[model samples]
Target: MYKTIIAVGLGGFIGSVLRYLVSRLTAGVDFASLPLGTLTVNVLGCFVLGLLTGLFERTGNLSPEFRLLLTTGLCGGFTTFSTFMGENFSMARNGQFMLMAAYLIISLALGFVLFFAGYAFSAKIRL
Candidate 1:
C-alpha cells in the first residue's frame, strides 16, 4: 500500500510538471483565440494513456503499484480538467463564442471517442 501510494505520488508530481511545461511552451500559440495548453495536454494524455495501456499489457506482469502509478497517477495528473474549464470560461468571457463552442464540442466528442477506442483496444488484447 505504501509503495503504491509513493509510486502514485511520484508519478502525479512528474505528470503535473510535464503538463505545466507543455502549457508554458505553447502559451504563445493562440488557437482560435483560446489557450492551446489545455487542449494539448488533454489530447496528449489520452494518447499516452492508450499507448501505455497497450504496452503494459503486452510487456508482462506489472505490480499493482506500478499500474496505479501509471494509470491513476500519471494519466490522472497529466490531464487537467480545471484548466480545460478555465479556458472555456475564459473564452466565453472574452466573447469568443465560436471558439468556446468548438472547444466544448471537440473536447467532449474527441475525449469520449478516444476513451472508448482505448478501452476497446485494451479489451481486445485481453481477450
Candidate 2:
C-alpha cells in the first residue's frame, strides 16, 4: 500500500510536468486556434495504456504498486482535454475533414460507452 501510494504520487508528478511542457510547446507553435498538446497526450496515453495492459497480462508479475504507477501515475499524468480540444479544432481548420470527424466521434463515443460499461460491471459485482 505504501509503495503503491508512492508510485502513484511520483507518476502524478511526472505526468503533471510532462503535461505542462506539452502545453508550453504547443502554445509557441502558432497553429491557428487548435490545440496540439492535449490531442497528442490523449492519443499517446491511450496507446501506452493498451500496451501496458497487454504487457501486464502477459507477464502476470505486475505488482499492485507497479499497476498504480503505470495506470494511475503515468496515464493520469499523460492525458489532457485542453490539448484534445485544441488539436481537434486545429484539424478542423486544416481541412482534414475525415480525421476531425473520426477523432470526434471515436473519442466521445468510445469514451462514454466504455465508462458506462465499466460502471455497469462494477455495479453488478457490488449487487
Candidate 3:
C-alpha cells in the first residue's frame, strides 16, 4: 500500500508539472468559449491513457503498480476528465450502454452544478 501510494504521488507530481507546462504553452490560444489548453490536455491525456492501457494489456509485462502510476496517477493528475472518459468507454465496451448514458448525463449535470455551487460558496466567503 505504501509503495503504491508513493508511486502514485511521484507520478502525480510529474503529470501535474507536465499539465502546467502544456497549459502555459497554450495560454494565449483562444477558440470562442472553449478552453483550448484544457481541451488539448484532456484529449491528449485520454489518448495516452488509452495507448498505455492497450500496451499493458498486450505486453502483460508491467506490474499493477506501474499501471496505477500511469493511469490512476499520471493521467489522473494530468486530467481527471480522461479518467472519466475512460470509465465511460469501459462501460460501453462492456455493453453497459444504458449505464454509460446515465453516468454521462449525471456526471455532466452534477459536475456543472457542483462547480457553480463551489464558485458561489467561495464568493460568499470573506477570507
Number of the top-ranking candidate, with TM-score as the measure: 1
Candidate 2: residue 1 Cα off by (Å):
2.1
lDDT of each: 0.81, 0.69, 0.70
- Give the Å error, residue 25, model 3: 0.5
Error of 2 at 15 (Å): 1.1
Write down the RMSD of candidate 2 (Cα, Å): 8.8
TM-score of each: 0.80, 0.62, 0.62
Local accuracy of candidate 2 as per-residue lDDT tens digits, 1-127: 7888899989888888887887787776643333456655665666666656555655657788888887889888878776667767888898987778877776766555554454344333321
lDDT, residue 49, candidate 1: 82
TM-score preference between candidates 1 and 2, better one: 1
Q: Candidate order by lDDT, highest to lowest?
A: 1, 3, 2
The sequence of per-residue lDDT tens digits that candidate 1 reaches over residues 12-82 is 99889988899899988987765678887787777678767776767667888888888788988989989
Deviation of model 2 at 67, angstroms:
1.6
Predicted structure 2: lDDT = 0.69
- Superposing all C-alpha atoms, what RMSD in Å does each candidate have to the true structure? 3.2, 8.8, 16.9
Pairs that collide in candidate 2 are 34-86, 35-86, 35-87, 38-83, 38-84, 39-83, 39-84
Write model 3 residue lDDT over 1-127, tens digit each, in one string: 9889988988898889988898899888875423456555665665576556546645667878888998888987887576567767887898988877866665666545544454454444443
Span of ten consecutive residues with least summed lDDT in model 3: 118-127
